[model samples]
Target: MSRSTSHSFSRSRLAALAVACAAVSGTLATLPAHPAAAADVAIHDIQGATRISPLTGQQVTGVTGVVTGVRTYGSSRGFWFQDTRPDADPATSEGVFVFTSSTPTVKAGDAVTVSATVSEYVPGGASSGNQSLTELTKPTVTVNSSGNPVPVTTVSAASVPSAYAPQGDPAANGSVNKLPLRPRAYALDYYESLEGQNVRVGSSRVVTASDAYGELWVTVKPHENRTKRGGTRYASYEDQNGGRLQIQSLGALDDFPAADVGDVLTGATEGPLDFNQYGGYTLVARELGDLRQSGVERETTRAQKSGELAVATYNVENLDPSDATFDAHAAAIVDHLRSPDIVSLEEIQDNNGAKNDGTVAADATMRKLIDAIVAAGGPRYDWRSIDPENNKDGGEPGGNIRQVFLFNPDRVSFTDRPGGDATTPVGVTSAHGKAALTASPGRVAPGDAAWANSRKPLAGEFTFRGKSVFVIANHFASKGGDQGLTSQYQPPARSSETQRHAQATVVNAFAKDVLKAQPDADVITLGDINDFEFSGTTQRLEAGGGLWSAIKSLPKHERYTYDYQGNSQVLDQILISPSVRAKKAFAYDSVHINSEFHDQISDHDPQVLRFRP
Candidate 1:
């Protein structure tokens, strides 16, 4: 028998029995004799072990016991072991296993013989605080009167968790006949009212579109005419009145190539009642009911012309810099982000530099940012970024900081802008020099850095609500406690203000030029401009450029986005042109999502405005 706290077998037979005993015990041990003898032991009776441990360098043996429970931990790649053997007391059988490999094959309730050398834990000698089992050998074992291994079967549809089952797959979608019907079971309020019900819903009508990860997305309008099936409410997409159904796919517009605006699809309806991932934004699709194609509605420009739009901007402070930062929290980083329909982020480090340990290059930074966004919430955002300035100096490790834009492809279609050798001139000369600015069909470049270091403007045009909207997302110079002649702080040459003011001038000039190009254009300029509403920099845009400030109209208590020294200031803003704001139906609201330090998730808060023009 394997060496144990107690005894049962002799030395000669002990070697062979040692394997069985070792396998039975959940631990390992080493013998005081030859190493070859220890290696030769083959376990026979696998499941009935009382104790198991591993051996040391010396000739030793281990203890083994039947496993009671197994649980997954950490990254879902490992497991822990609990004991439940005949001779083993249930009280001390709470065994914690240290798998031989990072990923183990064994699972709970398996009967096996483990050969190991066991010893008491050596405090902090690297292997956590558990006894050391250097080698875990699986020997021949018997379970439930069977000599061969027990067959492990994958859980079938009947055994699958209710959360992921029938009617969930793409073809069936989230249809009701696929879910277990029970009245008010598990807090399924909407579906509970129709427990044990069967209903027929008309084909769903396509509504607004969304695109994420370069994939196309379409929202379906639920059918409104109601019929009762087993007491459950059933309707078709055409009947939804104004409500919509959202669906996302990983292919481009040409993939399915079947769906079009006003297309009618018929399918069963079910409950995704708890779906609220997008919060206020319609980016996330909650399953209204299963939508199967019944027939097609007449094809028309189903794109409704609503003069209302809600635009939100935020500065996701220095998103990811070096590889070290990216690797450390890649999963957590992806989990917390909320993808707005349109997000204007600032301070996204582009090139690695001395400060960032220079790991993610510009191209790499862009790739990582894209991956991060998708991992957070997939099939929602289709990326359209301005190409980085290849000629600019590469900072720290990642590269230079380059501002970028990630748009929901389904809703907005884009037109790239022009590019040129335009550079943000350095020092005093930059303020006076003719700032090079260009507009192309679908491109932005390194030369754009003249606006902000690692933070430049990303301008693009996309169609929304049957109208083209121009978006200029930028990060401006920071407010570093310096006092300039003007409250907006435009310092003279050689001062920090020199670079700051030059950057602001570049952004302002671009805004003016773009507006002049489309006299009646719907223009939205948003980002961390770093200038308060009361500041002259913004005032100049309001007075001279005729831009409408979104924050100025909000109540004083809700105007601020960030607070410093107990005083709140609206440093970030959204400025719309008079033509867009003048749409009477375009009543706007500015919300301070991060107005309070306690309520803030990041250092900077996100500002949102809803206006239809």
Candidate 2:
């Protein structure tokens, strides 16, 4: 006999007496009713036509499924269950989350019947514009059997759509939120249809390396706008790669393996579909896949040719004397980047290195790095910089980071002139038919509002091969207060871009002043602009046809100096005046090292530009 909490059935067959009793009525009735009448409800029935549950606020009974996954510790204490027999409709998912608010009593692979009240839970509460999750709250589980087989659904190229998102509704503030669900026509719809389902992925390439948050982004199709390093190239706002997906491990942090770009995730990985704040739709995997290294190594640029001057830009990421990354950073400049003739360094801290005892001199800090470079078999390079007023520069608290210039005295000579300080603004002038700085190694427009609380531009004059080449180093305003793509705002606002635009205008005007002074002057303006090549900030810097970004000289896929969220984008740039731009004998390379690797000394990869003046 089989019995439920509300009903019971007989095991023995009925005798002829029961049959004879119904014979007079011309109908033969069995001892018990049909088994389906007691268990007609399915998981898909509760998860109805829309994102919200159709039977919400109504208590349902006899929902039967096999438990597929269980979360024991987190606040979202729940177990995922899928119906033994799925529906034919591809739009409706057969799996649903059963929230118990406590440890689940039944383990995975157990066939259990549940009775619960359906509810929709939003992750960020009511005000957040995030999608709602359908769940069964206040659930009571009755284990029917054990060791049941759990079904795994394979997600492949054909399963997802080629489009990233559906066309937004013009009436709904340009949001795709109201678009009808076409599961096979868009990536967002495809993920939404499988919400809370158990899925498996086959061999895939790692797009983004494993981050500190224990997440890895991968792409099933490796040939779609892929970079040489295995990362998907985000061509523009319109070409978002739909094959990208994130793999989040639900196991121990230490058990999660470290991976780099171009690595492959082999074997089968099964997990439950979860939508969270970090990435749109993530697969929280209980079993992680194996990582296979692609034998991809960091690149070393060719050494400078005879009579060619090599200039580089590096953002050391708040290099302070107290930090121990100096030696590794120097080796990158010496061995990997080939020790350029002149390098512009940003984020150099004060002598005391964040001690903040009113100390503004960075002589000791500069000497330490210069010594480390020589010890690493690099050239004996001389440096010039002006210390900022105490705590005026914005960076790590008390760090007072600023830009500095490093040059090989044997290859180039710095033109020394008087009257340069931390507060004075420098102007461009014509001297001996070339562009000259009013104060050599001086700050440009220090009093301008665009430079307030920011690292001011440093201009220096140097002579290479009997020709004067002017270089301007800059560290602009950061990209802060920018909303993420998954935020409530449809096309999230880039709030930091306004200040960066103003900062670019200032730099552009200064470049124009230099170009106006000498039309054929060899001027290179380069540093960590903290913006992308295609961004408006770069366009503004290149406006008036005065300066051009050297990063544009390389192919679009090879222009990135930084990686974020699996997308390799450009942040560091080298812009040159028209004189240098008009020349045919110029080359640039964005050295690949720090950004794609886990063991990085800095967060940015340095860019090297070789040219003859």
Candidate 3:
């Protein structure tokens, strides 16, 4: 799946409140400053030693701190203030956000007293599994003084813990919300302990590009899981790449720099550390660093040799005939990917593209791309795909996004067996010890519940270098319902994996069927898997030793096709059977192009695998 938008707390809080419902709204209501609301404890005491605040749901009075930052716009506007005098406990945060539900009059450096209800505001929602943000909501704030200097905390490699998260409590059913904050050991604990505080970071490398919402990602621990191209590699779930932090500006979007991966943010960037729905811990910058272009160029994979059959996977990010990026996408395929002999395309939409008028044919979409490819100096390509039943395939509604195969006729041939349709199930068969598909361009287990409302695996038989190669193109179920990495659950719930694991088993069974039919069958499966190589999904795909994720063949640092939230992780991959994997000379490349740049036509870096079957 692709990612998104503005890191605004107000909008996020609005959604969070709506999701948490009116009961939470009532609990965190504002009241006039009175003796009843006068607990008057230090900010750190309220922040407590755990992910959840100790003073949640309590009315507190005379809470004093210096305003470090203020959000005066949007429905959930508030000001972040830090206590002037701090206790010596590292487990408690000295700063806190005061939610007013409207514009705040206080400015940075103003000393203020707040009488409000302390709350553990969960971003997204309580069910979203995200860590709760400790906040003083619906406050009656009184400006006590002006021009007080806001204390700034510097964050660097040495300041952040190498460990990412703490173990969840078994009593709480894997919830870490009540666990004591291990600020010195866990990165999440460290960030949580400093939430709402004024923080500063020096010049740093931009890992994820500035998205459409004028936000980017930076890392303080530069060397943690460092990729060769200046990014972090999220190799596994256990190693969450703790140093990565999202960057957002409190100022106007027009002033925010458009930065790409490998760019450097020169000088100092300072802001109040806050938690939002889109990304967990973020620095909403009052002062932004200057963006310095690092001259990072799109990488080109070496052309496939005459003996090698080059197969690739590229997710065009919901491409339709009307899409404007056709030319740019064509150029990437020709110039950057060296025009792989066979490319598996994901998220190819219908002609009308989200019109939702029951249209399902995608001939126009494929034709536009093929024509653009030819114009970009690539060979004329032939594509095969099955149009899904309207609204059945999950994606942009009415777009009817489906997996497609594009093969170069000059270099390879597509086997077009008859009778393959939207609902037809593909079966593996053997003809004279050669593996073949019952319906060449057919759906794999189309009726299976595992593929409900998702793109069914598109199976096709092909001939390359006079050798039969069976390829199963898949755009598996996305990570739509999964909990975020910064969830309250210590090992945050990957709820989406259940469906993917089932999908993998379906694909795995199909591959095993073909292997059983033809023992020496050369089978390859590749597409936007929407999961990591190390996940249960991949494990299911590789279950019976029938298929192996070819991306794993590369060095650990170089095995990613997408850069998400500053972690270079694998979402797209190519898997091959023992017939292909046994030939260890096969080369694989996660061609660096779209995902690293803001000028991307697709959010995925295409994966290319070259092997002599």
TM-scores of the candidates are 0.40, 0.84, 0.94
Q: Candidate 2: deviation at residue 332, Å?
A: 0.4
lDDT of 2: 0.76
- CA displacement after TM-score superposition, residue 426 of candidate 3 (Å): 1.2
Task: Specify the highest-TM-score model's number.
Answer: 3
After superposing candidate 1 on the true structure, give the runs of residues whose Cα lies further than 4 Å from its correct spot. Answer: 1-307, 321-339, 351-379, 387-399, 417-454, 481-502, 587-595, 598-601
Tens-digit lDDT track of model 2 for 175-256: 5444555787766677767777788889888877775656788887678778877777767766667777888776766777
Model 1 residue 430 CA deviation (Å) reads 28
lDDT of 2 at 111: 77
| Residue 543 Cα positional deviation in candidate 3, in Å, after optimal superposition | 1.9
Top candidate, metric lDDT: 3
Candidate 2 vs candidate 3: the TM-score winner is 3
Native-referenced Cα lDDT, model 3: 0.85
Give the alpha carbon lDDT tens digit for every residue of 1-613 in model 1: 0000000011331121111012222322212322122223321111111111222222222333333222122211222222232222211212333323223445444443344433222211321211112223322222221123222111112221222111222342222322332322211212222111111223444432112221112222232221111000112111112223233321232332243233333443221111111111011111122333434221111112333455557554454445454432222223322234455655455555335443434455656765655665533455555444542332223334445555667656565544422242211111232212245223223355454344456676666766767777766555432321111111111123354456556656656665565566677888776666765567655666558787766655446555431233456788888877787655333333333312133345466655564
**Candidate 3: segments with Cα more than 4 A from true spot:** 2-39
Residue pairs with backbone overlap in model 3: none
